[model samples]
Target: MKGSDPKPQSYEQLPLQFQLYDCSAGQSDCSQCRAVPEEYGCVWCSGTCVYNQSCTSVPADTCPPPQITQVSERCSVLSSSQMTCPTPAVTPEVKVKGVWFQLDNVRVHYETIKGKSFTYYPNPEFFPLNREAPDAPYRFKPGGVIAVEGQHLTRAISRQEVKARLGDRECEVKTLDNTHLYCEPPEIQPLSVDDRSELPCLKVFMGNLEVELGRVQYDSDSLSVVPLAAQISLAAGAAVIILSVLVVILMYRRKSKQALRDYKKVLLQLETLEINVGDQCRKEFTVASFPPF
Candidate 1:
């Protein structure tokens, strides 16, 4: 009862006989689709068909380009130039002292090892006893200055441009220039008091980039200082060994003397018992001798 001639279908259908037109063919006036210029975009409209869409077109300059006023920091275009193009890219190389070098190849001349000392042994080379005051602190010290070489280091105009690091720790840059950079090594906390790990090589940095100047190692002949505590421990160990030996010897001598005393006491008891038995035997044999006398 509710069925009305099942409402006529409303699905989209294409005409059986139709010709396809190239929308991008740039046809200005065509029977199928005509391209028309608009203020914002080029549009194609079909008067006969319901199909219509935006069309691509080469924009014609109705007015001249904007005038160049202030100079751009990157590119400076000349007034006579027709086409506006970008400026050339920045080169990676920098010039210094007539020599050209890649920014990464910049070298920092610095003396890495001012002095080094061992935790136990002290060497005059690392800590010259003659050069230091008589009351100078123990040979083992924490930090020292790193003297940079090269005259070009002075070229760095500001401290912000130059930076330095030792291993993962950033060091304080004292003096910096094109030729030299003076820096104090970071105060590193070793895992243990006897830590003898090699000092990390000094890294000279320019802003965020790391400079590849090769690794710097400490001179092996430098002063090698040892901790005073380690020396004292060695002396204490020797004293303990000597004391143990003396104690063992004294104990052995004491045992020997006690054994000699015991042996002498046993001999004396035996002699006394023998004398008492002789007296008792004489008493027993001399019975009833009064009558005979």
Candidate 2:
């Protein structure tokens, strides 16, 4: 057994082989944790990464993210002297722990009611909304429900505080519980599996509580007509407007031409009346010269 070392190497200084397993610490979600090679001795357990041997509760050589109840807390009282918010007078998780993180747009400080949780809080100076957080793989299309599973999900449902978004579009939340949240994305432009374009990551928020759910992926089966339909409607509207304007201009031109004809007809009649009156006056005013002859 060794007690102390006069010099120790930093983690970066470790050998390439030793560095392989240490990379597991960077994984924040279950899928990523599980993706780490098992030979690394890393196992995803209870929403955290640990050596497979450390997770004695699960089956031997097994790692799984256990199903645990999730909740968000809002405490009305704060102790300025203690610089801490008192835990609500509610049922707390049995093995309670807390982690500070900035998940997407919202700053988060979640108490893990279960096991060891990593802290990912942002330093306000370097914080930009949803910039650095990794995303989980979530396949979805408009009108289809996407389920969000995590801690404190039930609390969100009961409080009617759950909201979700993909990119800038809102995802209408349908139902939620402790371990799962069901939401439907808004209609959008068509996307296909073969299309190598990028879309926004999934984000869930409730007031100050925020969580980055994952990233959306399109598949062959998924397609949206909203954008195409909108374009068609806009084109139709423009055509109708143009037709109406043309009709109005044609009617105005016709009325102007009719008025010009009417004016010319009245002037001609006046000229004829003047000519007849002058002739009658001349005959009346003529002397008896013609009679003398």
Candidate 3:
């Protein structure tokens, strides 16, 4: 009876299972569809979906912490050539965005390679060595070059931050770099001889810090500089004039001697003529004395 009751079966007689949807089949093979790893898989797509296989990941940004290194400068001098004198170090401090940093730190970078040995210091490319200032008397002259070396010159990294002073007078910065600064000393017209002010000292300021480079030697106006070129020209001109005068005198003397010789010849001719005339007269008198015998 149970087998023949199909038409009268209630809803409870239906099968409990439903057909499962094949997401990984019918469209493409599982090998071709490729299963994306959970780490990079997208949440909106089904686990077998190929659309979420590629994901874009952005890296987080980080700032390198500040580092401090030891610096041992042998000396600081106005001239780069002269490092013999053990002078004080020029330690300049700069304020950037309300934070202060040493010039040596900001201007230089320490680099180390993974497999390499020695530490590398990346100095500014334009940094100069063998720079020397105008010596002594010349350094006191206007527009004289004053070379500043052995210190970090680019503290604030701008033209406005680099400043130089020769005594109280401000100097024009001609060339600047991390290690060297070339400046034109202000035209210090020397005070009168009665003025007793000492020569100005060369001072350079990187930011608010100051470094005394050297003192400009006093140049005296009393030291008469006789121009050798002018003197030589004057001597040559005088010699030429004297030689010309001597030549003129020699020519005049030669003309005078020639005139004297002509005058003597004329006198001798006159004397000979007188002698002949006298003899002729004597002959005529003798003939007359004979009385035509």
Candidates 1 and 3: which is better by lDDT? Answer: 3
Question: Cα lDDT of all candidates, in order?
Answer: 0.48, 0.59, 0.52
Superior by TM-score: candidate 2 or candidate 3: 2
Higher-TM-score candidate of 1 and 2? 2
User: Clash number for every model?
Assistant: 22, 7, 0
Model 2 residue 175 distance off true place after TM-score fit, in angstroms: 0.5
Report the C-alpha displacement of residue 241, candidate 2, in angstroms: 26
lDDT of 1 by residue, 83-130 (tens): 232322222221112211122576322222223321211111111121
Best by TM-score: 2
Candidate 1 TM-score, C-alpha based: 0.26
| Cα shift from native, residue 21, model 3 (Å) | 73
10 residues in a row with least lDDT, candidate 2? 121-130
**Cα-based RMSD of candidate 1:** 25.4
For all predicted structures, in order, the TM-scores are: 0.26, 0.30, 0.28
Over 4 Å off, model 3? 1-142, 189-197, 218-293
